[model samples]
Target: MDKITIQNLEVYANHGVFPEETALGQKFLVCAELWTEIRTAGRTDDLEYSINYGTVCQEITRFMKEHTSRLIEAVAEQLAEYLLQTLPLLKGITLEIKKPWAPVGLPLDTVSVKIERCWHRAYVAFGSNMGDRRSHIDSGIQVLRDDPAIRVGSISDMIVTEPYGGVEQEDFLNGCLELETLLTPMELLAVLQKAEQKENRERLVHWGPRTLDMDLLFYDDEVLEEPELAVPHPEIPKRRFVLEPLSQIAPYKMHPVLKKRVKELLEELSDRE
Candidate 1:
């Protein structure tokens, strides 16, 4: 939750919509607020324990100069992602890109774009019921692991379970995983859907069977309800396959909507059965 601030660092870069702006280049001001744990660095007085502001400043300068974008918003967005990916110790970033000397023939101070980006903890439930089920699930996990924007964490053991929804299909190999990602909820969903598509997942039959199934169960204790997505996976409490593996990895993780722990939900479901 602690922060290190870098204010108004000037850089010369070529980033604008107009031809003159890109050809001749212009001066830009960048500001950054780095969020991380500074307690260890503060106590040990070791530079290694903390993020080096000097190095970060240089990185900002280099990134600004190297990338050319049509708008400051794009510049800020790309720069924030670059810094977060390259800097291991940086947990979050607030970035601002200021473009002064506007081409508009008016008396204006400057144009700027500011944004906040951070890592989010998310849990995903994966399963497969057809065609080398284990391999399909494993491949899906690997795809997530390989992505730079995602850091795969503790994974629950895969369990065999009967098919849900009375689909009269083969048993499924189901499991859950913990991951840290910089992608937003929607973007994360796209990544999971991509992995499923690679294995040729079809939606012809509702919960009937599939090559691979990836469900977004939770994201950072946040509750979301959209047309295509639902956080805490609306059916978490009722799905034994989801809870069994999820409890193994996150027994104490509380459901933001239901206000019950994973282990508690599992126990409650067991009592009913």
Candidate 2:
């Protein structure tokens, strides 16, 4: 990835924990690294093909002057998110917000907060057993496509599968979807939950029938074992419904923990059955 670096662009703003700090402003410095592919811009000498550093700097100036937050941490966070969301050519950012006048008693020049933020690739499993199954799946895809930060990359053919948890319900229409997104694993989970809620999904019973079921299968090869969520989906290897569809889209995707390709796992499961 190519880079654009902006360092110590200074601004005076009211951001502090003390009341006096709010009444009387202080100096703030911002440094940012914008990441993207600049090949097209370099080849054509086209400003449109690249992120304009001048425009980005001015936008940072505007944001610093407009918003008043108590902490530089908050300022850095919101500003980073804002830039990433607004700039179309930008793929990632490393941002630092420095407060020169922070009331630290020590003889420090400045106190600052820095962070890195970027996009991620994720796989999602979609299923519906209720009314208009195909419609539900299609609508979910449309919703994802509508989101600016999420790009629907590829889709697998829908397959019919019986309920997995021994529940007395209708067969589900299942499939897999590939996405490129700027969302974290937890944020992606929230988005999936919201999409399922839109289709009136309910969580009354464990693996019970529902209108829609959207599960986060993998997130950039991340392996997480949180209480509410698990990446690599935990049971994906054992479930033919998930493996079959996921194999169609990402047969070569490697499991983070198992260290095996999806195709290998699918073959293993098939042999067992």
lDDT string, candidate 2, 147-238, tens digits: 87787988999999999988899999999999988888888888888888889888998988888889999999788989989887989889
Q: List the residue pairs that clash in candidate 1.
A: none
lDDT of 2 at 104: 74
Per-candidate Cα lDDT values, in order, are 0.93, 0.90
Model 2 misplaced stretches (Cα beyond 4 Å): 138-151
> Which pairs clash (backbone N, Cα, C closer than 3 Å) in model 2?
none
Using lDDT, give the best candidate's number. 1
Model 2 lDDT, residue 199, Cα? 90
Q: What total of clashing residue pairs does each candidate reach?
A: 0, 0
What does the lDDT read for residue 40 in candidate 1? 98
| Root-mean-square deviation of every model | 1.0, 2.6
lDDT of 2 at 108: 83
Local lDDT at 116 for model 2 = 93
lDDT of 2 at 8: 96
**What ranges in model 1 sit over 4 Å off?**
none
